[model samples]
Target: MYSSHIKSVLEEKMWLFQLKYFPFYAEWMLMVLPFIWLITLPYWLPKFIVYLLEGKHLVIKMLILMTISLLTIFLIYMYVILGKPNQEKWKNVIFDQHIKRIAIKIYDATDNMIGGLVNRDVEVNRGIFYVERVPPLYWDVLKFREDKYLEFTNGSTGLVGLLSSPRAFNGIDVIGIPSAILHRRGGGSSLSQQLVKNFYGQDYFRNQTSLNKLNTLLRKYKELDEAKTFYHNLRENDGEEFKRWVAMYSPSLVSAGSVYGIESVAAMVFGKKPKDLSEFEQILLTNMYKYTHYFNGKAHENKCQKIKNGSKIDIKTYFAENPTKVEALIQDIDNWDCTDKPRVPLAFYKSMLAEDTKGQLLIGNPNSRIWDWAGTSMSILRHETEKYKIVYPNHLITEVKITIDTPKNISFKDSVNKAFQNVETKLASRLHVNLDDDAKSEKKQANIWISVVDEKGAIKYIYKRGNTHDKRRIGSISKIFEAIALGNRGDKYDYFYCNEAFQNLHNADGSMGGECQDNSQNNIYSARKVFGASKNLPMMSAFDKYVVKDNKGIHLIKNKIDDEKLQEIYESFNLSRDNNVTLKYELSFGLTNSTPYGLQKSVHKLTHLLYEKQLNYHEAHIMESLKYKIVKESKLINGGEKNSLFLKEIDSKTRKMFDKNTKIYMQTVLKSALDSKFNGTLKGFKSIDGYEPLFMKSGTTDKVVNEKKLTQSKWVAGAIKVKGKRYSLVIMVHSENGIGKKIGHHEIMKPIFKEIVEALNR
Candidate 1:
């Protein structure tokens, strides 16, 4: 019979192991055990009476308590075993207490705080994640190893009682910590740090010093530091941030089958905020958190009774003492709205900020198109709730100060957002409306590219439309190239032969007025005059013979039209510097098509050249790409020796990319552009009133259709200086009805020219 009893005991212990260690809600089953202990309280009374008489009964009872006291010292361990913190019979029990207005003044004081956070423009810049609203009395009553003031210091389980344990709602790991202590246990840790860890999880913590401390005094002070921080947050955020802090701790089942935060639970229980709850209601709520419940009193009645059984204070008469507080709270339940939503004020806050941060964009799109990278998460606000991720904004397009000079007297630096919108709208609306308007217009597609460069050469603003990629011919604009090429030709040639066979344009002459009458004659003209007339035939004729070769008839290919030289030229001109643009079509010298972007970019370079500054493409870019990140990685470089060596190697290559000769040659080409006395090609552009054109060039491409040569495309591109500020412009018009010389200026291109001019002249 003794062996049988031993076998039975072994079986019981194994069953207990499964219930304790396995992932089950066994806390519900074991909650009944606490009630058994309570039932044995009467048994203890008889033993106590016997001990007073014989003393033997006292010895037996003391011995039993000693045997089990080592394993189960804290009241916390008793409830935790059942997979929860409360006995099951009484799921949630409000102690039969003499509930009184103990903190009526405190409750009244916080009411304004609750309202200001929601209704007024309080400083709610920071979001409250979670904090518990534990009154001082609750902390006082925790039965553990007492400190100097008889306050508990978590004697049994301690802070590490629960490790990073996963839980069932809102993805918050239960952390084995009683959710109450995590939030309300407040202070030395910064919100910036805890926010990071709470939202991002414990894995985000590089140094879990908050959890690592073993010394009692040090840990207590550490907790006090966190407490102070949270208290300050309550005052600063008007308690809204702190309320949210309380919410995340124990995401309780406040309604049927749904979990919500402390704020929502308060609104659910008393139709008010935690700050507005009466002392009686506050105590009831705090006790209920020991084992989270679904707002219904029936589901948690056993735990409620268990709470009453363990209380040291007298509460039976206390319940009768304040019927009004209880009655009013129950009346609130009659009109209560049960839902899992943030307090109305916090919900309003997230909504207001949604629109302002949507324009924030991620930088890597390359197209420079705006996208709401923050999305619905409002990641800028949310991301900081954890550690400050260093790479976030850098990963977004970085913001650097850029200066802008606009025709409208607008501050481009301060108002670039408006510029981005207006420029895009004007271009998009023009293209959208005009492309569908005239049946006579066969312009397949069109685009415009405008960019402003600051004094420091930073790109302040850039605007683009369709056809920015494809290479469309820039006809007479090639004159600008010929002029620069000739000026930089490295050979001294006074005159170039203009043959009569060169019929550049229909019924038009590109010859010097000193001699030429018709295309049947041969003439010699100055190289500069060839450029001003956009005398395509003469320019092309002079190009291969005189421009490319010296007066001795030897080819002057100093900077050969090879890969490196051409790339250098393109880079200097800002023409198709990126691989996104192509330059497969060789320079025609006004023979075939070239990109409009290429032409505009060349004019842009001329503007800089006029200012006596230039972007050194080859060397500047190479060093810029390397140097951009140096400021960030300054520590790794140690000293200036390595940086000096890197700079020394690039010094010689960058020396002459924009030397005096190149600048002089470019400036001469720019000056010669407006010298249209010979051809009068650009004189017809009176479209920009009161604004004198500094220099100009026009281009057109023709196609023979039904034996009639109709103009396929027309372009007028140039630079104009107005109000001491310089601006460059490019215009392109395509029409099947003929967009040649007259139509380009009159129909499609002139209005846009006028808009730009008007803004600048204003």
Candidate 2:
């Protein structure tokens, strides 16, 4: 009973193994079978005997065991390969399927002139059906037969050299068959054999990452397996099959349309037919099968040498065309650019087509990168048509579709120009900015920046009113940056306002400028407390402790910003880090400097971060992407809609500007500042009465007048939420008229925003 059970188990295992991976079992055996002789040779027995005479019985057992294992492998190999159908026996295999009908459609951009009502057959387009395939053994391809001599037989075609390795190569003779088979990748395959596999290969084993034979084996197996069923049914004795493939795969005139077939490429590249190629020219043509770019579109000495070595033919012979004039013609072709396609334009190639239709319009010089998107798309259409071939009688293609999704909505240039002019006029008339003496003065500068992005994805921006990209000292709006500075503290240091850190910041008389109203000793305030008051003293102290880390090298604060996060913030703001923002440890940073073209861009980024909690990260990002796509395809941004990044030109340069990760921690700190009582800089928000609420931070600074007194340069930067829409508001206004007395964000800057929001809402 035990013996019967073991026999059944062995039989079952063998049968299942053979059934599952029949092809690998056969091919791998064909690779390793010859090496089995090393184990089974009778010579090993003599060696075992000699070893035993020398008292080496261990070696004898090892040899005997090795022989048995080898025999086991050899028997399995014999079973798989010997069982495979031979060439002669393939004739008996029958496939009952009828010939496949193929439908052809021609496209010109998004328009289709052919197909649908009028169906076209694949074979009808191709002229000169294939007569027959010369037997592989009869093909004689000799390259560089001798120096300056290239030769091939009269019937030899380009496929012979493209597909086959040299005939003299025998893996078993060069090196043992096993090493050669594994290393050389099965040596070579005849052109016809390769063509059969390429056309029918099931691609079951094709892997993106797999290399060489492992990649080929599974595909070959599928091909051979399919061939077993279809070899008798499918026939390519006529040129129709060859023409379709050559047109589809080998030829490409313009990539913009379904321009297929070698006839076009041949006319465009060589200005001649494929059959008329000289021996050396044919060598150039065939080697192109490996890489078109390397040989055809490159023209350096290295490129020249690569083609010479790859084809084993001389370039001089190829360029000369006449053997006697080889050396003289070498210089002529050497100077030629590989991409300088034949002078015959694409229109000429179309004129050659039997279809009475003229080809698609050719734009740009043919030498430039031809549009390849449509050409690549043809394969899918072909595959789909094949699947439904029987349903579409006469292999009819009713429709050929081509869609190009390019960026549109060129620019919001016209609307933006008119809107900003209105904002400037309203501000000047309402705020009464004085343009009298200053307007006539030497390049007197004033910037009117009105930038607002609505919830509906429209961006309206007007930079430095006069010179948008020019530099200007932006007023107290710089104070909000303290949120970033405070986040980088060494320890949770209390705002020690004892005036100890302010000694270096003393005025000419040794008194600090603008002392804080609260002069309490040892009264430490949180960073948030200082930010609300816009205190410059502790702000400078923090900068020294957290940023510069004073001369004594003592870290008065912890949680200092690391290099990486600091870099990210700096980049987001477009702030210059290489230049020290301060004069020295004792230096001061005021309203602003024109280090970058505009301050509005930086403020806009900060305000974007304020929306984080209210914003759905995925929804915002995907909507941003989808809206951009929709607008790009549709060429319009629906006005009054919400959830938009903005309407700007379609460009990749500004895409990274919409970062949700811009200022995360600062958002938490700023929220409290905005909610603070409407006093100091934010006093202006109270004037904005509407259905919407305000979240904001403000800054106030005065520009010195006559170098003795200063005039207020009021500023307010924030966002207003009305309905479901959010409009970011940044207003920087320096009155043309001098301030008779002190003013805050409420008077000039705040009113401008209130009126602008009203204008936007209407």
TM-score of each: 0.40, 0.33
Off by over 4 Å in 1: 1-445, 449-463, 490-497, 500-521, 547-585, 589-602, 613-676, 686-694, 703-710, 733-742, 746-750
Q: What Cα-based lDDT does every candidate model obtain?
A: 0.38, 0.38
Mark the regions of model 2 whose C-alpha exceeds 4 Å error after superposition: 1-445, 455-457, 460-464, 488-500, 503-523, 543-567, 577-588, 591-598, 613-665, 668-679, 691-695, 700-705, 734-743
For candidate 2, lDDT tens digit of each residue in 437-502? Answer: 245533344445455544433333322344234444443345455455444332232233222345
TM-score of candidate 2 versus the correct structure, residues matched by position: 0.33
Q: Write down the TM-score for model 1.
A: 0.40
Residue 261, model 2: lDDT of 32
